[model samples]
Target: MRTPPQRGRRQGRTTSRELILGSARKLFAEHGYAATSLREIARDAGVDPAMVHHWFGGKEELFNACVELPADPAQVLGHVGELPAELRGEALLRALLTLWDSPAQPALLALLRNVTGSKAQAALIRQVLFKRMLALAMAGLPGSAAELERRGVLVASQMIGLMVARYLLRAEPLASAGHDELAALIAPVLQHYLTGPLPGTGSAVPGTGHG
Candidate 1:
């Protein structure tokens, strides 16, 4: 009669990775992306900091794994690339549409739907927008960090609305709009939010006679 294998001793890397992931998820929900640290997650998991880095490279990668995000936010948004200021909005919009249409979209939509029912999940989504997506989109543009963040918030509102209306609610015409048509129609507005003048920035409104 052979003794049963010891499960704890046998499961080394797999168990440790799961522990890191579980710890990351709970800490991220409580403290958000910026506040959560890889070291803290590792400590919570009873793993060495080196183990967390070995498995997930960094905090961003760890967060991605916890959420089961199918694509890296950096890669998806980095599609904006380097382009003339005027051309970036359409490029960014196209990238977003492409992501939405990809096979990974189901995973993303699952996350989105979760936001409606869970405050923790909603905070997760918000943290991603502010810390990852918006920061990537707004980087290198002119303004103080606060102003840029404000612009990013406005951009987020429009993009979020488009995502919800077109994908979640299946609202008629928008849901049915061809990708190119939607991009062409909405890109300018996003562009304006991103790089154009805003009320508080001291740029005169085109028709309002106020700065």
Candidate 2:
């Protein structure tokens, strides 16, 4: 049989692990992926530095547990290029919209809502959504790799803007719009960001739409 001190130590270890997980979720929801650190999480959990490393491998693994990405955007998006050219925009938009509209949305929205209030949270959101999600979506386009990356970034910029308007700020029209309506209005713009010619390509353009 274990000694009394050993039983007490086991109970203490379980409690500490719970505390660490709780703190991690709150900090990740509040700050973001890139900004939160194991040390900071440890401090918040009121545990020793080594405890965090003992319980969770590192920040990345901790994030995977806390945020729980439902689908791997990198893996999901890799096949975007395989769709018929005309259908690509709709397909991509549908994928994103479906993911966001599902039950997973609450956690994602909570994270986004907290980002403006916490630097770490914003960093985390950016890395997950832009760096990982968009990077995977834009891979292997017919261009230089840098160009493809830039296109991915640009696409992210547009999507972020749309999300802010629709979900964050709750602007009129966009706020009231249903997912299908929003998708119709936004998918072509995303298409341009993904596969359209570069901005300086030989074309004269006139603009007439606002918002």
Among all candidates shown, the one with the greatest TM-score:
1
After aligning candidate 2 to the native by TM-score, how far in Å is the CA of 187 from where it should be?
0.9
What are the models' TM-scores?
Answer: 0.84, 0.64
- Tell me the whole-model lDDT of each prediction, alpha carbons only: 0.81, 0.71
Residue-by-residue lDDT tens digits, candidate 1, 48-101? 898888888888788988777788877888757456666767877888889998
Q: Which pairs clash in model 2?
A: 31-120, 31-121, 32-120, 32-121, 33-124
Error of 2 at 71 (Å): 5.1
Among all candidates shown, the one with the greatest lDDT: 1
**Model 2 lDDT at residue 14:** 78
**Candidate 2 lDDT tens digits, 41-123:** 99998988777777777876677666556556655676775666555666677777677677777766776676675665565
| Residue 34 shift from truth in candidate 2, angstroms | 12
